[model samples]
Target: MTSLTTTQRQIVESDLGQCITHEKLLGEGWSNTVSCINNKWVARFPHTPESTQVAVEKQFLYAFGKGSPINLPNLKQTEGNYCLYPLLDGKRLNLEEAAKLSHQEKQKACHQLGEFLSWLHTSSFTDENLSTAPYGEADFYQDLWQYVAEALPCDLRLKAEAYLDSYFTTVPDEERKPVICHGDLGLNNILWDNSNAISSIIDFTDLFLCDPAYDFNAFYSYFGQKWVNMMSETYTPHIGDHFWQRVTFNKLRKALFVVYYARHFGYESYIPGRIESIKESLSQQLI
Candidate 1:
C-alpha cells in the first residue's frame, strides 16, 4: 500500500472523524487513485483537474441509489475533488473468470445485465449540468476513421475507409435518439458476486448522454457478438433497428479511440491487436 499524502489523510480524518486503522491501494486507473481506508471506506483521489469523476459521484451517483437495479456507490464525502465511499463488496471479473462461466451462467449474467441497462437507459434521472456526449454518429465515424486512417497499415486503412464511406452515407444522427450513457462501461469496472451475477457497476467518470448502444460496447468487446446479440434481443424493443447500427459505430469508435491514444501514448505494441479488432468490428453492416 502506498502512503497517503498528508492532504489525503487529513481529508479522510476530517470526514470520518476517526483515525485510519488500515489502508491499502485498491487499484489505479487512468484518472484516479483508489485506496481502501480503515478497511471500510474507498478513498478516490483524482490526479488531474480534468478528472471530474469526483463531481460525477457527487452530482449523479446518488440519484441512482434507490431505484437502480445494480448496486452503486454511496458517497461518504460529497463536497470535494476527492471522494470517499463505503467499500463495496465483490471481486472484479477478469477475462479468465468470465470465460470460465457455463453458457447458462453467461446467459443469466447477460440477461440480468441487460435488464439493469434497460432501466438505466430509461430512467428519468436528468441533470442539466451533465455533459453532452462528445460524438454524434457522423462525428464519431469521421473523427475516429481519420484516426484509424493515420494509424493503420495501408491494407487495413483502405478497408476501414471503405467501411467509413458506407457508415457516413447510411447512418446519420437524426435517425437515432440519444439516451444517458455510462461512458466507460469496461469489464474492470464491473463487479461480480460469487454466483457470477453482477453485483455492482462502478466508475461513472465518463457518464454522459449518448446513444444507448454505446453502453453495449464494453459487453461486445469482452463477451463477443453472440453475447451482444443476446443482450440486444432484450433491449431492441426499446430502440429498434438503429440499435445495432449504433452498436457497430460505438465498437469502431472504441477501437479507433484505443489506437489513437495508444499512438499518442507510445503504446505501439497494442496497436496491431486493436487494429485487427477494429477491422473486424468495422466489417459488420450498419443494421
Candidate 2:
C-alpha cells in the first residue's frame, strides 16, 4: 500500500481544519493516490507533481455534474496537486457481485448506466481544446505496444501486434461526432449501494472526448451483448452504423491494456483472466 507523505497529511489537516482522526488508503492508480479521510472525505493526490488532472476533474464535476442522474464527486478543496471530496457511500460493484444480480437487478443497473451515459454524451462543450483524441491516434497504440509487448506470452504477442497494426491502418468514420466520455468506465469506478443500485460514478481522470460507443465497450466486455442490448433500449441516441464495430475494437484494446497494467502495477493476479479475455477477443473476427 502506498503511504501518504507528511506534506499530504498536512494538506489534509489544513483542509479539514483539524488533525486527522482516521485515514485509509482506498487505492493507488497510475493517476492518483486515493484515501478516505475521517470516513467522510476522499482525498486524491496526483502521482505526478506536474499533473493537472486533479484540477481538470474538479472543473468538469462542477460544470456538467450538477444535473447528472447519477451522483458525481463534490470537491470540497483543491490545493497543490491534491483534491478532496466527500466519500460516496457505496462499495465497488465488482464483476462477481454484478454476475450475482437477478434479471430485474441487471435491467435496473443497465437503465441507470444507460441514462447516465446519455446525459454525459449529450452534454455540450464549446472548448474543443479541452477535448483530446488520444485513442484515435496511431502513435498512442505504438506507445502502448512498446510497454505491453514484452509482458505478453509469445503466442499472444503475435496476435496483439497484428491487432495493433490493423487498428493503426483502419480509418475512423469521419461523420462520427465526438462526445464527452467517461474514458475509464470499468467496474471499479462504479459504486453500488445496498439497495442494489448504482450509487455514483467516480474517477474522471481519463475523461475525454471520443466516440459514444467507447463508453459502452466496458459494459460489453463485462456483461456481454445481452446487457448492452438492455442498456441500449434506454439510451436516447440513435445507434450509428459502425457503433458496435468501434465497441468491439475498444473492448479488445482495453483487454490488452489490462494485461499491461496488471504486470506494471503489481496486480499479477489480473494477468491470467485478462490473458483469457484477450484470447477470446482475438478469436473473434473484428466487426
Candidate 3:
C-alpha cells in the first residue's frame, strides 16, 4: 500500500499501472523519499518544491552504475519528475561493520572500491550528453582562487580561500589537474547487507569530475585517521598529482561548496557544523 500524496499516488499509479501497489516506505532522504513500489522497485520522489538538480544526479547515476562493484538499480520508469529504480538490499555500510569483516573481505572491499574509482579517474567521459572534464591544472584552482582573490565577505569562504592560496603557492598548477571523484562518498550513501559487504551505492547528486584527493579523503572524513592512513598509503603511489597540492586544493574547494550549500539550501542548524569544519580546514595548512 503506497501512502503518498494524492498527486504522488496518481503519478505512480499512472506510470506503473494500478495493478501495482506501493508498500513499506523505506525512509525519507535528504532530497528524495524512497519507497518500495510494485514489490520489486524503489520509487524515489523528490519532495515538494522539487530538486532542480535531480536531473544532474540522474546523469551521474548512469556513469556510476557503469563502474559499480555491486548490483545497482538502473533507472527504470520516470514519471512526473520522480524516478523509479530496482530496490537494492536495504542496508547501510558503516565502520562498525567494516571492522568486523575478515581480512580477506576487507581487502576485497577495498579492491572493489579502488577499481570503481579507478574507472572514473581513467575513463574519458567526453560525450554530447556529458561534459568533458575541464582542461589542465590551472583550471582546477582558478575558481576557488578567484573567489578568494575577490575576497568575499563570508568568513568561512574567505578563510577557506586564504588557506587554499597558501597551499597552492607551493605546488605547481599543472599538477592540480582534475579527475573524476565521488564528491560526497559518505557512509549513509553506500548500502550494504548483513555480510558487511557493499550491496549498492546511492546518491550521485554530489558527483563531480575533480581532484582525486577529494574522493580519497572520504575515507578519512567518514571514518577516521586509521582508514585515512591506510588508503593514502595505498593510493598515493598510484596518483600523479602533487600530493599536498591536491589535498588542500580539494579540501577548501569542497569547503567552499559547503558554505554555498549552507547559505542557500541547507538547514539553519547546519551552519555551525560547517563553520567549525571550515575553521578546522583552515587550521590544517602544513604544506
Q: Pick the candidate with the highest lDDT.
A: 2
Winner by lDDT between candidate 2 and candidate 1: 2
Q: Per TM-score, what order, best first?
A: 1, 2, 3
Instruction: Report model 2's TM-score to 2 decimal places.
Output: 0.82
The Cα error of candidate 1 at residue 188, in Å, is: 0.8
Clashes of each: 0, 0, 0
Which residues of candidate 2, in runs, are more than 4 Å off?
Answer: 126-141, 145-172, 256-280, 284-287
Provide the lowest-lDDT 10-residue window in model 2. 128-137
Model 2 per-residue lDDT tens digits across residues 1-287: 43588889998888889887888899978667899888888888877666555566667787777789999888774566677888898888678889999899899989998899999888874343355543233345554455555655677677767766665457355524667888898788999888788899999876777778888898898788999988887898777666676787777656665666566556788777776656566656532
Residue pairs in steric clash, candidate 3? none
Candidate 1 lands at a TM-score of 0.84
| Candidates, ranked, lDDT | 2, 1, 3
Worst 10 residues of 1 by lDDT: 133-142
Q: Using Cα atoms with residue i matched to residue i, what is each candidate's TM-score against the true structure? A: 0.84, 0.82, 0.73
Model 2, C-alpha of 150: deviation from truth (Å): 8.3
**Whole-structure CA lDDT of model 1:** 0.72
lDDT of 2: 0.75
